[model samples]
Target: MRLAAYGLALIAGLAVTGAPNPAPQVTLDRAEAAPGEQVQVRLTGWPTGTVVIELCGSGGPARCARDTSAQIHVPGGGAGGAPLTVSVPPGGCPCQLRVSTLDTRFSVDVPLLVSGAAPPDSGTVRQAATGPPVVVGASVERDRGWPARFGAPARRTVVLRLRNEQAAPAAVALSFRVGRAPSPTGFVAPPAVPDLAPGEERVIRIPVTLPALALGSYEIHGEIVTAGTAHLVVVTTDHHPWGLAGLLALAALTLLPTRRPRRSIGRR
Candidate 1:
């Protein structure tokens, strides 16, 4: 029975560790295009989530039209594709086609050269400069923690600050996860955020429950997806559950205490 218990412990530990996931990728049909031209994009090995694709210029802020951006849904099994068709925004060249999941599970920026774009000067290319309609910033009260705090499981709320930079109101959907990254199917906790007025800012708080004895860092990903762009803020939190695990191990060992060596009075 003791051997069996040890074996089960080993298995349980392995299960908690989990297997590695295949890295997500984005494959573009062409590398360069003229402004107002369409490019096809294929997503492979991406996990299930809602991803936004947009054609954005290279400098200043992301410049893409609300009508040209596309959102794709990757289904179950990590095997999904989206044949995204996006045209290079007029004068938004020397730009990149940006793709990112709502939870930031997969993010890739594919660069492209657009016709009529100013030639490079000293490694600098000029293009239309504009700002994205929406952007986000993230921070937490505590960035690192132990397994427990004052006898309770350590937990924290990630505070997200969002801004609408456009002159018009922007409505955005907020999706976030704070735990093991790129979960096979562990999508949850999509906090609702009110729409922002022009030049308006808002604050959102997402609370996450940290595992008491699970080892490793936790990922705090918050993304705000508007019609034209999806911006993500990725934060990593360090947690040491080793202290709790060690205590548990010690308690288990105490249940089968080691026999003390018999001391002979003659030795004294």
Candidate 2:
């Protein structure tokens, strides 16, 4: 009887104190996906704010290859949380999708399997005939249409031009790389393009962000069907003179003494 009374008291105390809730959890709509397929992700118990999501490979020397990883921002709040969509690129592999707060104080990793057979080529060649039916072009542009500055984020665009040389529509796989790294975002799995008619040319654009902190020489390479590769070189340097000066000024102000000013006594 005494033990039972103690148990009741403990339960009452817990109810009054309100136990802390469990950490955030993540769930996927499906366990596996094919190349170029989209997967739905759901997050629960996430705090109210912005969260970062990253998809990274699981094995091999290139386990966390930039091309295999993509970053996304999620606005999380409430019990329902938020829903996100991620694309699976070609080549089967065990991958992990991680979601976390900006500071990374709280996070969760969910395993995902990406598997699928490659699409067969139709054998339709382009009339331009230089080579493959697909051509890739890439360029880097800074945000706000400004030139690529040293300490500012830049936008990279990979454009794929498809030409239907055969009488019927043709299907092909496209991939891109930046400075020996796979395009950080899955550029291989873009939206399905409508069949192109004979002599039809279609252009598709894939964009990725290069953070402001990045510096040094980098190259962007785009390929179609392992042929018709295009390359672009980008050189970034530290060019934020104004920012550095401002930081120095702020530091100097902080070090100044905070004593109250002395009053003038001549008038009195």
Candidate 3:
């Protein structure tokens, strides 16, 4: 009789506090990618309803543009899962890919690395003429249309033009910086140009990777040091729309004429 009473009490407690629900989850094939790269994603444990997927900037609003989001319907009471292919978009930045169900309050957030790409060239070499004994040439190569906006990683190439004026061969060291920080990994280092003949000029191409950064203005600086000569080059990334809007507001404020101090006509 005591065992029966205890079992009845346990059942009543369970009925009052329902069972725990499994949380929704999402997984990506990779964690990092350059802009325009394709990534495979798998989702499971969602509630029985339509699900919304979004790729939003880190700390930004929840809903992204249609180009960066997708909607999938899970039928048969959400018993099955769904597989999705997401393409990284241009103007890359650190972001999160979120998945949420319509009926229940179940959601999942996945961190994604959206690396940056170089901007197009303006048909002229961008460099400092007064630095060291090297000339710098930087260009971004991107294909047209979908590839340009949603395909492979854009290629960034930096060409260094060097002329050895000294009689003996010189050992040159090269370093690169992005924004105010050092270059991130996965970038191909500049090749060493040792034993450069006297009065010989050689052009070396260095491949650079522009990782995703916060939406702002960034400067990429490259330096070549050899035989007391230091060649430096600085390139600026194109300002994002938000950054440009801030600049425009600042400029408008500066242009606004300040009210002249009211003249003391009564005193005069």
What local lDDT score does residue 71 receive in model 1, on the 0 to 100 scale? 65
> Which residues of candidate 1, in runs, are more than 4 Å off?
1-136, 142-154, 179-185, 210-212, 252-268
Residue 122 in model 2: lDDT: 36
State the lDDT at 183 in candidate 2: 33
TM-score of every candidate: 0.43, 0.37, 0.34
TM-score of 2: 0.37
Per-residue lDDT value at 37 in model 1: 70
**What's the lDDT of the predicted structure labeled candidate 3?**
0.53
Q: Identify the runs in model 3 with alpha carbons over 4 angstroms from their true place.
A: 1-18, 62-65, 77-92, 102-104, 117-268
Candidate with the greatest TM-score versus the true structure: 1
The runs of at least 3 residues in candidate 2 whose Cα sits more than 4 Å from the true structure, single-residue gaps closed, are 59-92, 117-268
lDDT of 1 by residue, 1-268 (tens): 9999999998999899987777877778888776567777787777777766777664422244335666666667655454444555434456777777754456788887666765323433333213334446677766355436323456767777777777655646556666787542333355545456778878778776665554567777766666535676777776665666677888898899678999868754
**Full-model lDDT, candidate 1:** 0.63
lDDT of 2 by residue, 1-268 (tens): 9999999999999999897876789888888766556567677777753444545443321122234333333334424333334444222245666676534567788887756523323333222222246443334443443433434555665555666676543433234444424333222223333335567788877665555645544455444431122223232212233454566789999999999989978965
- For each candidate, C-alpha RMSD in Å? 18.3, 15.8, 21.1
